[model samples]
Target: MNQRVLAERARRAIPGGVNSGQRNVPGLSDLVIAHAEGARFRDADGKEYLDFHAAFGPPLLGHNDPDVNAAVAEAGNGADLCGVGVTEGEVELAETLAELVPSVERVLLTSTGSEATFHALRVARAATGRRLVVKFQGCYHGWHDSVSLNVISSAEKVGGRDPISTGILPEVLEATLVLPFNSSQAVRQAFADHGADIAAVIVEPVPHNVGCLLPEQEFLRTLREECTKAGSVLVFDEVITGFRHHLGGWQAISGVTPDLTTMGKAIANGYPVGALGGRADLMDLFSSRPGGPAFFAGTYNGHPAVVAAALATLRKLRAEPVHAHVFALGERIRSGLTEVFDSLGIPALVTGYGSVFVGYFMTGPARTYDDLLRNDANMFIGYRRRLLDHGIFELPLNLKRSHVSYAHTDADVDRLLEAAAVAARQAGGEVQDLAAASTMGGAVR
Candidate 1:
């Protein structure tokens, strides 16, 4: 079937014709992916495109990796789901997490990143006996009530209560204190004013949600110091940065450990798995014992197949040169895109950490959401949309980072750069024409 037929059928079944709100972009929503292999996927119309989105950075090793798939098949042959007791895979996965991640002395498994963050916040509130939670403006922890506000807010609502979705209670919105990213003073002040009432401060170490607002080392250190001084739990939501950035997580690079860490995305190489780990005392609160303060239960928390996928993915990451390969490709894409835009005389900034890149239509580096306020949203979106027409697939949305999977090659990087130059020229010409037309109209007046 064609994309149009599939899309029409989907809209009648799924709300908004997409399962996730982020998948509902104009150019992307209509696309029906027929199949995906390493580095590329084909649409229902039988056209192939080089995939840089990597399904929002989950396919770290790439789509349909044989090793990961083999592990899943092997594990599924022996065991599936036994909800009553723990399996060997579950114990091994948790042990592996504790061994790999720095902040994890103890851990709990969940089915999704949202569940992990929800459990982390609950543990923090219970451990501290506090009511308020702190999060940065552009950092998205999860879709949960506690950290759902102030992501991608407008200028007027930058520092205010701008809930991403309706149906969140007023009390829930108020409970979350949204502050600016990369501001040491703002973090310190929030802790000073509400130190006694604060339960936790959660941040996305790099703020990839707003297309890579690189966190200052001092800013992260300030978070650690203030949270320590205020006796509040510090949580790093590394769902996007974990495993993909480094085998040890972003904390290894920054050396600033959090009281709790929530991780997912590439953890299982596109399989459904998430984990929350932290200081042993704090994690013990999730125990179902009589005196345990927090509650945590899920039937599919540690499904055998998911655990197998994660174990296999982590093992491959440890044994192979996955990080080395992807990181080099990431740098290649960033530099290539920078050269392309400069040649076109288009003001742009491409910023990201290992294996991720985001092209921002702005004048300078973005340290915070406030800095990103100057980003040209229309040009950003238009450039990505035009890239799709050139057979390169990135989510045509503002503030979304593109991923480089281990499956991609140096040749693929060069092809993307060549296509990007053409796309940039097209998008740039349209913007220039619009500016000229506006100036001429003003002169006539």
Candidate 2:
């Protein structure tokens, strides 16, 4: 397809004409990618890129790993095309996760992360019979209205959080209580104020949607303890972190098994697979028709291709110490990029866990909505465009934290830092080299 023709055609009839909102970025919409392989791909215009986005981190082994591709190819050939039946793939994948995450007693798969988070809340309310749901500011739990508040709140904003979208009815926002992430004090305050009425407190243990905002050391423990004391279910939205940071996701690393855990993204090696599983009592959400928590049915929620891919992915992950490699590579990438910014005399810091870290030319140890929001968005956007031009692709979603995937080699890390140095010179304000580079490019020198 002609890149310009495809994009123009999409805009004509496709209601944004793209699968996800992030694809509609000003520069990205102008370039449509045709095929991807390994760690690189070409746009419709055939400009090759070092794919840093990597499908937002699910392409951990890199795009089109031979094994993953083979699995897909074989499934497409003839492997449980029925889409529903007593297939060993689903059971094997579930077993792998159960063995990996102690909290998971039973598992149900879905097509995307949103569904997993959605049903987890349903399970919580059904199990606890409470209506109120507590979520932190800046954490995104899909598009569902109950958890939409505080997604885009900047640090300087008057109130800590403002509902990110408009179509969501105000009544839905009423059920959501927004608390500052990484603040055990605020969580406690909410519990004291609305604990009795709240059925569950859902959160991304590490909020990566708006740059990666890690919680304080005692925050997770406090969340668990308070939720327990108040008789409310604690849900960990592990869609992005699941199986990426470790075998069991945040629950394993933190040693705090939530009442409910949602898994997606990497769960099926980029295939459309998600799951909500935890304590058996809390899993009654999947009960038989008319008896379950509510409606949880969809035709392709648990497709066989995705299930097989997940089984293959988990088998490999379980056999290999992926996190160990990721940790080592992450340190190199973070250190390399940190040095780049520092050498340029720019104000930036890199922070995150495992293979995920971000270069923020703003602050260090970002831990809350306030911390991430207060960062330099202007510089961030400028750097993003520069990186894309220099062949690195990152989602424009709040410029939170970025990732260092398993596929990233030492060369990849080196190039990333090199790219950072190049982009730093393009910063619109006070960047010494940026002035010279801009002038040379016929921009405002």
Return the top candidate by lDDT: 1
- Write model 1 residue lDDT over 107-138, tens digit each, in one string: 88999999999999999999999999999998
Q: Evaluated with TM-score, which candidate comes out highest?
A: 1
Please provide, for model 2 over 151-265, each residue's C-alpha lDDT reduced to its tens digit, 9 standing for 90 to 100. Answer: 7775665254477778988777788888888889988988998989899999998888876777666999999999999999999999988888887888888888798899998
lDDT of 1: 0.90
Query: After superposition on all CA atoms, how large is the RMSD of candidate 2?
Result: 3.4
TM-score of each: 0.97, 0.92
Show model 1 residue runs off by greater than 4 Å.
Answer: 288-291, 436-445
Q: What is the lDDT of candidate 2?
A: 0.78
